[model samples]
Target: MRFARTRRDPVEVNLTPLIDVVFLLLIFFMVSTTFETRQALELELPETTSGAAAEVSPVTLVVTAAGVYRLGERELTPAELASALAAEAEQAREHGLVVEADGRASHADVVRVLDQAGLQGIERVRIATTESRTGETISPQAETP
Candidate 1:
């Protein structure tokens, strides 16, 4: 009778260990990764021919498509706006006003609001536009960021 020697081979790769390592790596990345969010400026801007007067956002006096002038929620006409601003001025030290008009709103209406707002002793008057977040309009009026 001849005696034969048996050779044993070792398994080179283990799937379970590999899967565990992969999951550990995924968890590490999930915990260690930092998420940075970029914030955009408020207001959706309307397209305009002159981009210079496009960037500015201040205390907005909104003019709707229906020609309703609003200082926030309160609707005011040209004369009413003057009175409202005058009232605001009497209560406060400095008067600042910004006029926001819809793209469809009449240009005359915006100018009229500005004119009336000025009469109320508001030194700072800006036309609100959705151009830049920092507010950079060219109306000789100081832009509020």
Candidate 2:
């Protein structure tokens, strides 16, 4: 007597569940992530004892120690800066302007930025500064150039 051979079905892996799980994880990560916008320049801002954190502004100008000017993330020449400021003047006046100058940057350079802003009719301008470590306030009249 010969025994009959039994045929079995081929094994298949169901990837639908795996795909669904992966999709859920991706959505979870995307929803939980926080995004922050930061400037490209590296600036060690000057410190002041009475310094206060400033609110975010639509216009931000960065002045480097080498007298380089950056409007937002874009580097601008002194001449180009004037035109750029003119373009953003409306927004700057509405949302205000924040000037972030390096600790070693020249006072003239900072003044130039302020003057440009003044000419644009942006009355609300704030200088960005860090808090002093010594906890002592220095008066502007006490400092000698």
Candidate 3:
């Protein structure tokens, strides 16, 4: 008796499901991820239980109600302030900046100071704020610097 032979088909892998699952995972992560942006300076009042303080005092930049720039105790014009900051930054003190704006200081003045600080290679800049008895922060009033 003669036996008949049958042809066999080659095995193939369908990658559509794998690709779809991968894309789904990508979409899931994209949707689940969180993004935070700091559009302004962050200022937090010192708590009663705050940690130990550093020995070095940060560079102080004061914006008076009259919109004058004071680097430490010395008052400086905008141009002078920039030059002074550049010089100080070259020292590489690794200290941040403390910005204390008067209650009547203008917002523009504060932002300008911040911008200048950034340009002078200052990495950290803080806004000095006061805490009320009610646990609320009181920002300075708006006045042209």
Candidate 4:
């Protein structure tokens, strides 16, 4: 008696589906990844016409029309404001001072602040103003603080 030999077929694996799934995952991750743009503190910066961008973090003083003064988030009296300015000036003379005065704030109050800043030997002082709807500086009468 003789036995017949059967035909053998080659085995194969299809990788097209696996490759497609991997490609879809790569695209999904790429599209879902978020990029951070800002890493510093947020501030409502005042606009200026001729002033160039500030390079250093200067001691900022905010004055309201009611003659209220603020250093950071805390309210400061005239004396405290002057002393703070002097201390900051002593720490880093290169870092100047910036004064943000409201439109209705009195000129006398601004002058007084300037005088205090000068007493602290802070020569580089600037006034903060917001831009108009037209994208131009609202033009505070005095260019410098």
Candidate 5:
């Protein structure tokens, strides 16, 4: 009397479900993450209680606390700023000018920009300000000289 041996199938792990779960988690994290691009200049903008969103402008002038002027990413001197503003004014007269000055920047620097805008016949001017923590208004107004 002899006994016959039986063969069994090899055990296997189904990875499709594991792969699906991993992909779902990846998609969830990608959708929930936020990306912010910070400017090179560390500027603390002035806070305002009442402000309205400004229309998009073609020209943007940034003034640093150290009294440095920047047109776009390029730094410029006061004299160069005037000429640059003139050129921008020609193309952006309808869009107007947007000035972003550091909260600690001198009033004179902002005023000078305004004066140049006036000379270039760009009447529409806006100064950028952050909304107060308590309120949500982005108002840009010129201080009375």
Candidate 6:
């Protein structure tokens, strides 16, 4: 009786399982990935334990009681403030700005600067305020017209 030679099994890495695992991991990450929500600069952000926080970043123009108009540190005029704000806006990823006027500053002072900021097509201008004792910054509300 002649016996047929048995065929040898081919040596191979079965890639189907590995491929399936890789696909599963990919899908899991896609479904589980967390999206970025806030876009503000993570600057040496001024923080207070109890006060509110700004939801967005804007060209912060600081106005002291003495009628000083400043962006970061440099001073500006009303017309120049408008142009400065516009120029600064080019660097901003967001268009919101705040007129950080001191509590002792005149309301008209804040309004004038705000008008300048708005003149450059800036719409979302907010006032910055600090708590009396805590010194934590708070979001200033808009006046009711």
Report the lDDT tens digits of candidate 3 across residue range 3-92.
888878888999999999999999999999987866865545444443332333357778999889988778988778778777677542
lDDT of residue 139 for candidate 5? 41
Better of 1 and 6 by lDDT: 6
Instruction: Find the candidate with the highest lDDT and give its number.
Output: 5
The models' CA-based lDDT, in order, is 0.62, 0.74, 0.68, 0.69, 0.76, 0.69
Give candidate 6 regions above 4 Å deviation.
1-50, 56-58, 91-95, 143-145
> Which ten contiguous residues of candidate 4 have the minimum total lDDT?
136-145
Candidate 5 per-residue lDDT over residues 1-145, each given as its tens digit: 8889688888999999999999999999999998786534233454657466756676888999989899887898887988888878876577777888888999889878877887888876767676558544354565212
Per-residue lDDT for 34 in model 4?
94
Q: Which one is best on TM-score?
A: 5
RMSD of each: 16.3, 15.3, 9.8, 15.5, 15.4, 14.0
lDDT of 2 at 37: 78
Q: What's the true lDDT of residue 38 in model 6?
A: 61
Candidate 5 residue pairs that clash: 51-139
Each model's TM-score, in the order given?
0.45, 0.55, 0.51, 0.53, 0.57, 0.55
lDDT of 1: 0.62
Q: Model 2, range 1-145, lDDT digits (tens) per residue?
A: 9999898899999999999999999999999998887534233445557544445777888899999999988898777878989989999888887887788999888878877887889877766654368643222211111
Q: Per model, how many backbone clashes are there? A: 0, 0, 3, 0, 1, 0
Q: Which stretches of candidate 5 lie over 4 Å from their true place?
A: 1-52, 132-137, 142-145
Give the clashing pairs for model 6. Answer: none
Could you tell which candidate, 3 or 4, scores higher by TM-score? 4
Cα lDDT of model 3 overall? Answer: 0.68
